[model samples]
Target: MKNKFVQILVTGILVASLPACKQRPDNDAARAKGTGAPTIASTLHFADEHTTATYETAINKFFKNGLFRSGFNGSYLVAKEGKIIAEGYNGFLDPVTKTDSIGEHDAFHLASVSKTFTGMAVLKLWEEGKIGLDDDLSKYFDKFPYPGTTVKMLLSHRSGLPNYTNYLEHYNWDKKKLVTNLDVLTSLYTMHPPLQFPTGKRFSYCNTNYALLALLIEKVSGKAYHVYLEETFFKPLGMTDTYVFSLDKAETAMPSFEWNNRRYGLEFMDLVYGDKNIYSTVRDMLKWDEGLRNGNLFRQSTLDSAFQGYSYEKAGARNYGLGWRLTEVENGKKIVYHNGWWHGNNTVFIRLLEEKATIIVLGNKYNRGIYRSKQLCDIFGDYRQSNKTFQELENESSNGLAAGGSQ
Candidate 1:
């Protein structure tokens, strides 16, 4: 029975990766326009068509052996240049109902991957001169407990601010009611939890850093967090399926599940933004990846600042950037990526800038194999061939895979 299930899953993934039986009108119009650009759905930016197919074959086989055999459940998308090489979705959207299976358009809770958008929003506002990276948190939130923490510190995880989720876990808050970002800030001021370390001490990953950023976005943009992101990033970039999820819409949104098929229930922490709570599809995330690479969203200097490691004091090749994590690989090629785990949802998004490749895997059924999505990078470039390079990547992968759901 297990072998039969694996065979069926492999067949499903290949079917999902195959081109549609009929071309749509938009694809026809795109080809007619003669710009040589693919339609949004068919975006393929590879240099050579045959090579793209070859990589797709290897990638598909990897998924077959790595994920399908292990009972991985979620969405997988691998794209080169601007074109998708291979992509597919597997498993149940709701385990109880078992009625609605995962589909290409289904959006999963992005978890911490939402930080990429939150980080970009901060940069966007900074570039527009509405806010400054060095400006103190007090400038936006009058009672922002930490006086020295700045927007840049928050973006790069250098603030040393204690994670709000940790504080909330111990506090006697009414989980029945959704806790807002303002509540998070209020808790810091009222409860007066000690900082993890002094400001600018070193890199410390904290959810509070992004919670404050969401509040800052609201302060600077004069719009709700979700509205600001939709107007500034989603709509502009044609990411129709992406949105900052809200509690009121929980019933309608896609649900996340644990390995034993139990639903991951929501808590008061669900209300907070920035650190998590964005739901998006693979295609929409691809649009985001492309926008960041092509300088469509921000100036080249802004992206450069966002990509470089802010903490040199750290020993490892790993460093935290604005919204992305930078893993300095061999040959000075930095791998910009982020992994997210909230509830039962786990996601790995890797951007290989030099190769112009993207590996995105989002799983709602709590499979650790999702993190193995990074191994897909081995096929795209020579970065994974060396024993030293492979060892370094393996080390980084261990830390990322072990990261808790709050991250």
Candidate 2:
């Protein structure tokens, strides 16, 4: 499937004058001075030629030895200091026959990574004084079964709401009916499923949290969740290839396939948007990373709240932030990331906050190897000194050892 490789290295000496976007503090007033829309970073600081070459070589080697060898069928991009040091697209749009080649513009289903967008949208509204983080769910949805569950609880995955997918499947929802965000909320009200735990007692990654958040966004903004995102984020950030998925757009969206090359048919749960169903290309995802870093879409305080850990009942490196997964590694370094798996699409969006590095991998064909892309973080920083080697960590993750809290 490695039929084509595209590697772009910024060929220039280091420019001393370019402002480091990562170092800038988030300023909402500055963002409001303009059209009040987020702007993608136009000028980026490029690593020196030697550093760029080193990163490019290491990334290519990693791809050849790991992901590509495992039949990876999507696109990947690696950027350092805000410049794209390496990127490539492999495999065909149709997995079975090697026909049309995947390109930079191709969009893959983001699955759980979609939660990041959902989470940030909620926070954006909060920043605008449109909603309250501590506001109870009942304040928006009158019949919301959980009384004390707040928007913050939902963002942190501490809502204790049962996952709608599990309850819908076990409770015998009609297979013929496609479920929407409203349907999920209605089911919660009508079925009145018991909470997985008391609200805010512990961290429980539930898709229902974000699903209801989608409803909250609609109620407060008077716009559909997808429409709001398109207008507020995607269009503003110049993420032309990114969007929340809808059935009407099914024909144009990339299709997913099983590991063995079997296509996945749409099922009853395919229509939901908040918990999953975002489609985007690697380029667009990088723009999102840059937008967040440049303080165009959110204030630094909001970003801080989003990245802050909420649940501490258990002691471990893993923790859930508002919409991201945090790994407090050695040297006080934090890796903020999100991995997604839905049907056969496996995606990874990782941001090395301190290092100003971003790793994005999106694949339509099921490949556990995609999750192992985290090991590549060592190429940019000192994340390899842990007790477990990257290979060992990869094996554990691929074997479901790390699947418990992962989406």
Candidate 3:
């Protein structure tokens, strides 16, 4: 609910430069509600004169509406033809630090986005004969048994498991027993009952499914989840900086990023910065996107199976894959995507086959799930080039400790 009048100040500069010039635009009531909270000013404007970036109009409006106003910290990189077309960081930045400031490396929790790494690890394990997708979960762990669920069901989220671990968050479990894959599975017994629907009956994003899968990974690979990821995916992919939730690494985190909603004084947190967290860089993610396209992680035949729906069911039983979400288009481009959400962290990783592009955004704050996501997808699928009046944001921090640190 921002007045359109004064926001004009957001025009003509790099969208990324708004934070250094943070001054509430004469809006009293709006500032009070978000008093003392972080802020970011971002607006992506597309000129009507050009068309390449014109397809980005919807995304442009979203950035204008303060979608940038709410996040812990964030960074985004848009790639095309193997080059970074747009890169931005906002909020929690060091105001007077180095040209490359603290905002350069704030690490954030991947939350469920960690699932992607987990999923990738599992696929790697499968290649080594550690586990099979069709194997039943009951065979892997003995603590809490669900005889009917299979690895495929678990990955596809058809295990009928309701994210039971969420219930435990209501209780006071010591740090030793909170949020781990095992703790979540144990809490399932106390969480109401079994699945709301039958196995392979529907599709709902149940975190418990992943927690259990993590256990399956450990039991089969005989390797700790974090360690396994470090060895297989992180090391081999040259994504050395990415991790599950490492604490010592957090101390060296990059400064968090945000967008200041200029007129409304609305601040949005886009990326997550944390002590024990998932660490990565735009370069690393780009490697992943490319790997999925050219590498042979899963067999060609298995790749189809892994990305295709295991069964056809309506309602919650929507489009999904082994560890990815799949969508089919009658005449449009088919997409494979999945989003990760944990606490205030949000991430969306998408692959568009027809466009041969991948769009990934990782943020520290939460709350702009559906609307903002749709807007981003529109930009990816429809952006037309525009350089006429389009202004690119520049990073003001040159004192950052690791400005060019490869994550």
Best by lDDT: 2
lDDT tens digits by residue: candidate 1, 1-407: 14322211112223343342112134334333332111123333323545443454445446656786766767777777766765555655775665555665678899999999999999999999999999988888885778898899999999988887887767777778778898888888888888888998899899998988998999899999999999999998889889888878788888888888888777778878899999998888999888888877899899888888899895777898899998887566678999999989999889998888888888888888788777677766555533334444344434432111111
lDDT of 1 at 74: 74
Local distance difference test scores for all models = 0.75, 0.78, 0.51
Candidate 3 Cα outliers beyond 4 Å, as residue runs: 1-72, 93-104, 169-179, 188-193, 247-277, 315-318, 330-332, 367-371, 379-407
**Could you estimate the TM-score for every candidate?**
0.84, 0.84, 0.67
Q: At residue 129, give the lDDT of candidate 1.
A: 98
Stretches > 4 Å off in candidate 2: 1-48, 385-407
- Tens-digit lDDT track of model 2 for 137-190: 888988578889999999999989999889998888999999999899999878
Q: What's the CA error at residue 379 for candidate 2, in Å?
A: 1.3
Say what the RMSD of model 2 is: 10.6
As a TM-score, model 1 comes out at 0.84
Candidate 3 minimal-lDDT segment of 10 residues? 263-272
**Ranking of predictions according to lDDT:** 2, 1, 3
Residue 173, model 3: lDDT of: 47
TM-score attained by model 3: 0.67
